[model samples]
Target chain A: MIHALRISLAIIALSLLASCTPTTGTKIAVNQSEISKIKSIGVLVKKDEDFSVRLSREEMSNTGAAFGLIGVGIEAAVRRSSDKDKEEQIKPSLGNFDPQAPLTERLRFHLQEGAIATSEVTDGGEKTAADAILEVTVRQWGLRRCPGPAPEVVQAGFNVNGKLYRASGHATVWEREELYLNGDCRPWSMFRSEELANDILPRALDALATKLVYEILYP
Target chain B: MKRLIRHFIFALALGLVLSACVFSNANVNLAYKPVEGSKSPLSTVKPLKIALVVEDQRPIAERESIGNKRNGYGSVTAQVKSNSDVLTVFSDALKTELGNNGHTVVADKEPLYDVMLRVQLKRYWTDSVIHFWDVELVGTINSDFVLGKRDGDKPILSQPGQGTFRESRQFVTDSAYENVLNGALSEFVRNFSRDPNIIKALQQAGQTATPM
Candidate 1:
């Protein structure tokens, strides 16, 4: 009996010590009613002087800046396992950020698949057929703020703002400012803002679409 | 039987510990900051306020455990890593480099900044047959669309890199990714910085690039 008891206790201790702990969180989402509202609205794209309707390829090109950055480097950095991971473990987070891609691609990836007609066209001094042109005038594309890893949270926020207009008559229809927040899982795993942007951008775009739908249809 | 059981338990404990450590190392979190161009300094005609939107919709991990020639007879276990993480790796690198360059990175809502910089990855993938990873970035600058502004004036940059992940696998000690990342970000900063308007705007606003 005593031998069996010792073995059971040893097993329990090992079980407790051997387990791995992981961090968890959900992507931010908007209200269901808002989603339905955006889907209902249909605005025509203005072809003449319709810069706002199409996200210009030039305006879209700045997304490359995220690739060339380097510093203390990722070697010493520690990070936490992203919620996307199957088996989570903490490691150093990467802190660099790309200002362009998040707002355009993340938003387009989800919203483009929706009911509206979407296409990537090159404007060679001619107008094309489409409803309610979306002129995405990205005033700035990059990290608006970069806070280092800390006992304090390494908060990183990215901003995307521009206006949308009617493509046919070239009248301003909608304008918006988007802000995204993410970072600071733990003290040692500082500077995961770039990693955080992956989740944050998609979430922000979802929210922006919700707002856009409401403004276009309800307003 | 007793001796066999003892060995089994010891081996299990060791396996668990080693697996946890290996997994912990695999989860790499990266932040990308853009640095100023070494050859071409940044010139801005107007102050800029920028926002980044990343479309990170990666497919769920599809694990395939089948006998493959690479591992001889052992099962080749592969799971899909999120594409968002890959984007994050490059994005963080740009953020850091740009921060090192002397420019105020506006990541929040501010009216004073005049132009917006946007960065994005249209597609990224690794083809096992060719053993190559392809990365593409789309970058653009949106000036305050003053009425009747010409379309072609907008600053645009696109850079794509295809490199062998296997050649660098041996030397890759966490720092291997930097080479690829730097290649992508450098192209972006260089192209945009050459514009005289970008520099003029920076000087006019008295905006100094903040340090990381």
Candidate 2:
């Protein structure tokens, strides 16, 4: 009886292990009817602070165990210092590098391509006008040497939270937090660091916004 | 049950204390730092023109993340991964090391070459699992290497190398992990460099080699 019980438990354990599998992402949610109503969107970007490039989080290290909160406090400070080091490394590349103008331009271009009229709307939601509002908060965006599967490999990354709402009724039609790195992909070379910072990073982010808008408005 | 719960709590606290600087889901840059005192074998060997090919056979998930600080129930609290592709980094390192040993490492497969070596990574991973005030940082690499003539016939030599490192640590650091991973890779590749069979094969192949 005990042997049978053991065999039964082993089968159950094997079944549990075999059942573990990773699922791919679902197809983009397309509400065709809702998208049809969103003919025009006013892009509202919430940028209150300066866009500064920082190193990937793993670059920061607190190498030892913390004792009694004080150690934790010191390690935090050191880690912050390491975190801020990349901005200085890329200072030469940051010559007037701004993502705002280009991001809006790309949005307009994509939205128009999607056949939805698009315009820039300032913070005063009540004052300005478009059919709907596409408010985006760029949670994180910029270029850095990717925290690697290889070191000093340049990669541009972005995480954006977006919401599309009707201006008249303010009903949320679409909302999503989109974007992340899939692998330590090397899309650019080190010698082109300047081009990446000045041109590629901004362009990459513009496309990110454009893709989000593409998904929402194009169904 | 109470004692188990108490131990779990202690483990959680210790984990938090140890991983105070850990960045969850972060990629670590395993930059090229040569392993110290790793040159092995006292046998004299001839340097021959070599071709190197490295295949990474680790699962996609292992390629992405090798280690995690998981909750007792097995949810990841923190994760670590290599900042770059493993194949490229490992291949480049092996190539450089070969070059250092006076061997010309090349990409060409023409009859001009002597021996072509293929290194397949069977398993490569690292982890820092915390439990009951014990923090263990572990790095492992298992490799299968084969050496054959430029004729691409039967292989002259085939061997396996495994490198592992585990240490009780206060925490896992970027530098510490880098060193351990490098050590594991160095040790794995040393099988090719340090093995007498491989050495004798390379020398004999060199003597008969007709490089154009």
Candidate 3:
């Protein structure tokens, strides 16, 4: 009986470990020659909304209520408190975390790395003196639960949509949407969601910017 | 048999803890000073008071992964920092070199100069990769330069002159990385001052009077 109990526990732990493993998916296309022709590029980011995690208490409560939970209101309240605790723990490290700044910087770095000059351009503002302009729209960002069990494993990811335009004629030269995922099974990830977001989000952005530059320069 | 199993488990836990402590943060400054005693070929071509336009749009801090990854363990990363404005540093370095070589370098809105020298930074970083026995540091600096008259936007030397400098060094310490960067900067100064096209532009600017 003792041997059987130990084997059962080991199997359960192994299964949980497998479920928490992270995975990524991406699709990108570009015209290498046209992108390489651009000598100096200006970057502009659209500020649509603040970044928020997808699997928040509000989203979960809505889903629970849709499924007609027995005590939906109380359950939501509990989840909200739990998430608030996690947020408080992550608040110290997040010193003025402007989601747009990091993404813009990464894009500029990669552009310069490819021997192309870069400058910042305002959206709907005066035209810059660059050969081409890159417009970025951050569609989705934050930490969310990966598809799995009740104690669902969480992952940090973001979706970036970018369009490159010729400065002279404002014609779309190259376009791509990149999705990045970093699903490492961190210890106590649920309780440290904010910390995980702070750590992995920049890495995801770096990976996305690298891919974008590769597609544009090398196709 | 039970004692052996307990000891094995204890050793495995100790190894995991030790592996977790392998990662560390390294702060690196990218600031470099101008190399003294450099000769400029345009020194004898007559002094031309030129407006120096230097624009830097690079990030102040850059983070990158440093170590190679193991099968079950992840790679160690480092956050490289530039405490000072890198653009300003490069600009100042160029200005000092020009001033030392008997040329007037001004950074102002006045249109009193003969021509405008615009230097735009493209890429500046120290990339490190772990080799079999040591780490290799590659320092790179790339910029786009345009020397043109104040009245028109067209470049006098050419459309835009591109200058790139790279230097590599093998080291285990972070300070050696800075030396590599300084070497690249010194190379840039030497190449920019000796370019034949740039000398021709300076000579033309010195011959022509101020535009009305």
Candidate 4:
């Protein structure tokens, strides 16, 4: 009987630990390039509604001082996991592209380095004196917590859809949609008010921009 | 049961202390002025009398602090907010930069100018994130400029420019995010003035202007 009880307690502890862990989503893929022959590119970043951090029902229910120490430990674990992910997944793929700049600036900076002149195109009506126009639409651009009843994970990333058009004819030459997630898991990791305006979001954005730039320049 | 209570209290105290130590509220102001250019590119040509109009349509230029919101016991995270008049300050900065560039900048609705420069602020914000002991401030601004002869006149040059400035500094007591914003504004103005299209538009407007 005592052995059975011990096993039950061990299982409970393990389950609790699992519930505190963070979870990550899949990495984005680089699509075929369409910007090779284009000498000048006009970038347009469409305005979207503000994005906020979203929490799941599980995160909402798992509250109170009883789980306080465990929550802190879980947060620390999540941070460590995020750092590890950054080192292993993000840095290796992105290489030298910096995440500090906005998507438009980064694109311009990278394209300019490759001898391609870049101009910003605002409002659809303005004349874009470039060979092609790159229209960027940000569907989701913030941090999101995994909606779950199991392992806890938070993702900081963006979902972007891009279309490149030939300016002379205004015809779409290339279209791609990408979702990049940088997340970490911890058991019972229900942090109520974590700041999402951090390096991770920018890094995720940088990753997306890098992938797009790669496809544009090399493809 | 007593031990559980003790642990809970300890955790709560720890969480509160962590939140208190890290969270802050700062009011950022972009107070930098642009230096006048000694050799304006438009020096040889007749200085075009231009109307400078700034439009700021952003809803709010501030990110509010997210205080400790307890989900369950010790799961509290703190967030800092920095608020400022981002649009007004940026317009002032741009005007100073234009005047420094040796352009006659007027703020009138009368159609009495050679060309009109309409600048619209699309986005301006500072994203401040705490990483370990340092706070990273990423300042970004996007503005659209339309240079036309009058309100309904065909635009000579219509372009949008964006600037991103980043700074990571040790979390200090004083407000340093303002410097990052100012740096971004300065870069924006500098880039705008040097844009090949913008320079060309000014020169062309000077050559085509009806003599007063």
Off by over 4 Å in 4: A1-219, B1-24, B36-45, B60-85, B129-135, B172-174
Q: Write the per-residue lDDT of candidate 3 for residues B84-179, one digit (tens) a residue.
A: 566767887788878877788876587688789888665566554332222344455556677888736778764222222222222234454455
Stretches of candidate 3 off by over 4 Å are: A1-219, B1-23, B31-35, B57-76, B130-134, B159-171, B209-212
- Evaluated on CA atoms against the true complex, candidate 2 attains a DockQ of 0.02
Alpha-carbon TM-score of each model against the true structure? 0.26, 0.45, 0.40, 0.42
lDDT of 2 at A28: 33
Error of 1 at B4 (Å): 27
- In the range A59-159, model 3's lDDT, one tens digit per residue, is 34233333343344555667767755655655445556666888789889988987899999888425799998888887766554443233534555566
DockQ for all models: 0.03, 0.02, 0.02, 0.05
Best by DockQ: 4
TM-score of the candidate numbered 4? 0.42
- Candidate 1 lDDT over B59-157, as tens digits, reads 223112100111111112222233245655645544543444544455435544433444434333221110112122111111111111111344432
- Evaluate all candidate structures by whole-model CA lDDT and list the values in order: 0.32, 0.60, 0.58, 0.56
Model 1 alpha-carbon drift over 4 Å, by segment: A1-219, B1-26, B29-40, B43-76, B79-89, B124-212
lDDT-superior candidate, 1 or 2: 2
Q: In candidate 2, what are the lDDT values of residues B25-115, reduced to their tens digit?
A: 6566664454443333212446677788888877677766766654332245676678887778778877866776667887755546778
Output the number of the TM-score-best candidate: 2
Q: Taking candidate 3, what TM-score does its chain B reach relative to the real chain B?
A: 0.71
lDDT of 4 by residue, A1-219 (tens): 999999999977765554311111112222334455688989877646344333332133323224455554455455545544433433333334333247888777766876889898885624888988877777755444432234445555566677777888887776655444443333223322232234444555655665565445432
**How good is model 3 by TM-score?**
0.40
TM-score for the A-chain in each candidate structure: 0.39, 0.69, 0.64, 0.55
After superposition, candidate 2 runs with Cα above 4 Å error: A1-30, A59-73, A144-147, A180-193, B1-212
List the TM values for chain B, per candidate: 0.38, 0.76, 0.71, 0.72
